[model samples]
Target chain A: MKPVSVLKVLSIGLLAAGLVGCGKQETSKGELIVKIGSVAPLTGPQAHLGKDNENGARLAIDEANARGVTIGGKKATFVLIGEDDQADPKTATIVAQKLADQQVKGVIGHLNSGTSIPASKIYADAGIVQISPSATAVAYTAQGFRSALRVMTNDRQQGKVLGEFAVKHLGAKRVAIIDDRTAYGQGLADEVEKAVKAAGGGVVAREYTSDRSTDFTAILTSIKGKTPDVVFYGGMDPQAAPMAKQMQGLGLKARFLSGDGAQTQEFLKLAGPAAEGVSASMPGMPLDLMPGGKSFRERFNAKYGVIQNYAPYAYDAVNAMILAMEKAGSPEPAMYLPELVKLRFTGVTGEIGFDERGDVLGGAITLYHVRNGRWEVLDTVQGESAGKSK
Target chain B: MDIFVQQLINGLVLGSIYALVALGYTMVYGILELINFAHGEVTMVGAMVCLAVVGWLLGLGMAVPWPVILMLGLGAAVVACMVLGFSIERIAYRPLRRAPRLAALITAIGVSIVLQNVAMLVWGKQYVSFPALVPVVRYEIAGATITALQVVIVLLSGALMAGLWLLVKRTGLGRAMRATAQSPELAGLMGVNPNRVISITFVIGALLAAIAGVMVSAYYGLAHYYMGFLLGLKAFTAAVLGGIGNIAGAMLGGLLLGVIESIGAGYIGDLSFGFLGSHYQDVFAFFVLILVLVFRPAGLLGERVAERA
Candidate 1:
């Protein structure tokens, strides 16, 4: 019995040592390990889009590592520490702190504006550079957090274009609005309301729903009574698809419009034939029209199977951070902060740079209509024109 | 006026699904006096199974009729949920039968969480869209539009409720169930086989939940693992408001809750002078629950009976 116990102890010790050896990082003799964090809702209803964002960042890191990055004259290997926030604000802050504790030089997400707005303070406190790929709420960048920046057009631009197009182009006189009550949705809806009233369209009805709600018949039925020529929904595809179906089921004649959240292939698949005639605004040129868009999409599709909506933007976000770090010759957040502010490059989306407020420069909003079960680009409006119209 | 009619129709459609699910909770509570919190997950399993079968059948590219495909999915969902319900009672609750009531309640909640995680694993955390199996046709009545599916849902739910009522009121199995509920030891001595009756009650309740699950997924045109969470909550509320363990009360409570929620959402803005919006619909449901609890603790139909401890 004594001999058997000694053998068991020896085996257990050996197994523990082996597990520890497996966890040890494989680095070259002098290779500097740089960690970049990616935070998004990797689970829940919006997981498809969140995973798309993470995959985009991963692709950039892989490419950077493959090509070999150097910081401060030392060869660097980039690693991504992806965290799931589950798209909740409280969870996002917790994830932000986790990444901060891990000393990630920069973070590429907290995808929703609701999460980003709250998480930004944590990143700021940590002195970590944070860039969001898809958050569009105006308040995100307006909070005076130097750590905050976004690669996509703000809701002000997208909402203006949508509101203007609905009245000026679609000839909508009275427009009804329904928002999912998230920071992103409500902010975009507010901006659209201003644009609609400015464009000489009467605001008929304003309704609200939760992000998790699938039933909109009560609200939709309420909106139908006002007889608006167009109905605008500021929400994501999960709710949008069912709302579209319910709209048809209730025999509402109003045309439906939404923001970038509804601009997804998943929307077309989920909404089915009901997707026809629905319009949405995405905050970039069409993918094929971007300078590196075609190649990036092919590579992304080859790897991830689908682009979702914000993969290109997320890809650009990672590349921007890398370019800033390379320019600064250091991976330190403070060292690269100034370089990132002035960084300009032709990315997969377009020419990427930032204003003093860290808002993307010269962003364009593209309007699309669902035709024959596909998103067909209808119009593209530059930032100046989009703002000037309102 | 037309808006009122439209909202009323909408309320009825939503209410029917709630009523069906509430019956499951009520039936289980009547026999075991345990909440059976996993009943909602059982409903979710029903939806997921039905969608999975429908997706598989569609993938097979057979020349089967759409109704036939839907029926096949429903049948699979019913069988799966019945088995799941029976096992949940046998495996999770049976041992706790003589334990403290709190122990059984906590175990029911644990079962609910386990089932939710299991479902999330089987069907990844994404909303699965229900295919447009039934070709939708709209009919106008009293200046309100109702779809063929909506009409079918109301009719089917009503028929099922009626069948459940008859089963409870007139059947021998139901008598055994009542006897067991009254006193398990007494029923055992009377040769009623209390265990068998309890199991059958669970199976029957699961059957109703499965049908309700399908109806909800069909009406909403989507299904998700988390869908059962909110749905189960609302159904439980319906059960409590109607008087837990009461069949007819569950149905009445469900319809009233649905109508109240719908009407509240429809006119909330006007009612509050535009200070509040339709999103407050859920607040109204809970508010009603509070009012009922405060005013009538025994619920609308429940009679004050001595605790069975």
Candidate 2:
């Protein structure tokens, strides 16, 4: 009887604690505490990029809080609630639901398209705006989710620039393409394949690999038999770096090309000397060439060590959401959602605006090649005409 | 012809590492009849340990030669994994020896997961690069290139396998080990310490796995905490393909599996009319396993053993 009484008392106390924890009260007389969610793979192979995005969002939040933003006649304090999705789709949706339940007004991430596509619906249903900093799959925004948008250009624009450059600039007549089979990688490869054909280059081989694979010898050997002039990989640095090394080892003389996922500092480090002569395409202009890029880079580097990739876009994502909140005069998602869709500004990455389908408008793609262990810009292609071509 | 040669080279290199790892699984399974799932994590730990040492040595800015640094790293990885393997068996497996076989299997998995997460914490989640310790010198043969490292891997693996075969066949400890494998109780009655033999077996397996780990990291040019999972899985598949408790079977199975995977990946697109690409390489490995188990349950080189039940 005494043990049962003790158990009843413990259950009652737990229920009361849960209720008290769930209830929120605003304090300090019109000082609004706005919760913003940032989701990325904080732990995994892509953690470096994910952490860069988180740091970018944090820097924006810190700057906004320091400046003391005002929303609806109240002083606003932006609080970033960072969640690790581990770059997994299932984990991304769980994190999204958690953020939604936590009443976060906006989300500044989901770094990969596979995670973003599934999580976008959860955010939309919850009336929270999701501004992805790095997801590039075109299907992400084309899903008709009003709350979905991105600060960076989508894969369609980036892939076209890569394909045309491989043919017209690199003089590639026969091309080989490989993708990691992720939504983002496959989508970009599809676009690159189409653009290569349109640019009068023949695709000699099309191969697929998983994102987790490190061995590429068998596939590379198969592709080598075709003797393609250039080999393009649609995957992140983790897989791409190994492929590059293996290609070199196999005496495959074809030039290596990749999308923005491999245009990263980690790529150079992992691939070592094999990274030399590898060409890659990234969205947006060269960082130094962007409007506010130089100064922003110094500040970001001073705070976060080095920018891996997508940090500038992540910064702009948070800034755009905050600007929308300021314009709408409320931090509530419903109030700022419409303003966010129509917002336009010059960001660190250059002009930031979304089209009807939520893809960035008038974006640019930069081509780079690794030389002497560093990325050097080869050319920059504006996406306005490319967008029309799509 | 060039494609065939290139893929053969690739498959042999890949298979050699698998054979080293499968030997660990087969040895443990031979004696204890328990699948030591954590054997894979031990391999991962070996790689991570070696890389950490290499990174630390390079950071010291000492003028030690590259080969010296490579040897030192390999030495440290082997020693560390030997101790780790012993501790894992002592702490996780020995206590459960008399328990149900299922319990020991579950504990092995638990130890594996713990090792993976612990490695993730120590090494962080980034793919740590393995520096080019071995100088790259490629030789072109029939339009296919083979690096000095590839030749070393195959040669070293062959030497190690021959050495291991001699150890198991001609050594006194091998007689003790074989006796224990037959019956632990009878071996104990015959004055062979089963526990000691088992611990020694784990240490030897760890040594081979450590060397295999370093080879894989060098070959792939990067090491990650999760690298062990897939590598171990493939090696386990190899062991089963050769016949799970047989050492010779593991070796044969590993090389066969590797060649099968490489050639399958090379020709899968053609065989399936472009419907299935080389990404189905993993499928070929498991598919072979299924075919072998269905037709020849004892494996390619495995002998049929009567069940006690």
Among the numbered candidates, top lDDT falls to 2
User: Taking the tens digit of each residue's C-alpha lDDT, what string does model 2 give over B1-309?
Assistant: 978998998899999999999999999999999899999999999999999999999999999999899999999999999999999999999999999999999999999999999999999988999986777789998878899999999999999999999999999999898899889999999999999999999999999999999999999999999999988989999999999989999999999999999999999998888999999988888898889879888888888885821
Measured against the true structure, the TM-scores of the candidates, in listed sequence, are 0.82, 0.82
Candidate 1 docking quality: incorrect, acceptable, medium or high: medium
The TM-score each candidate achieves on chain A is 0.78, 0.81
Residue-pair clashes per prediction, in order, are 0, 0
- Model 1 Cα lDDT, one tens digit per residue, A211-276: 999989999999999999999999899999999999999999999999988998989988988999
Q: Tell me how far the alpha carbon of residue A47 in candidate 2 is from the true structure, in angstroms, after superposition.
A: 9.7
Off by over 4 Å in 2: A1-134, A292-354, A385-390
CA lDDT of each candidate?
A: 0.88, 0.90
Q: What DockQ does candidate 1 have relative to the true complex?
A: 0.63
Candidate 1 displacement at residue B179 in angstroms: 3.0
Q: Candidate 2: which docking quality band?
A: medium
Candidate 2: deviation at residue A132, Å? 4.8
How far in Å is the alpha carbon of A334 misplaced in model 1?
A: 8.3
Model 1 spans > 4 angstroms off: A1-135, A146-148, A291-353, A385-390, B306-309
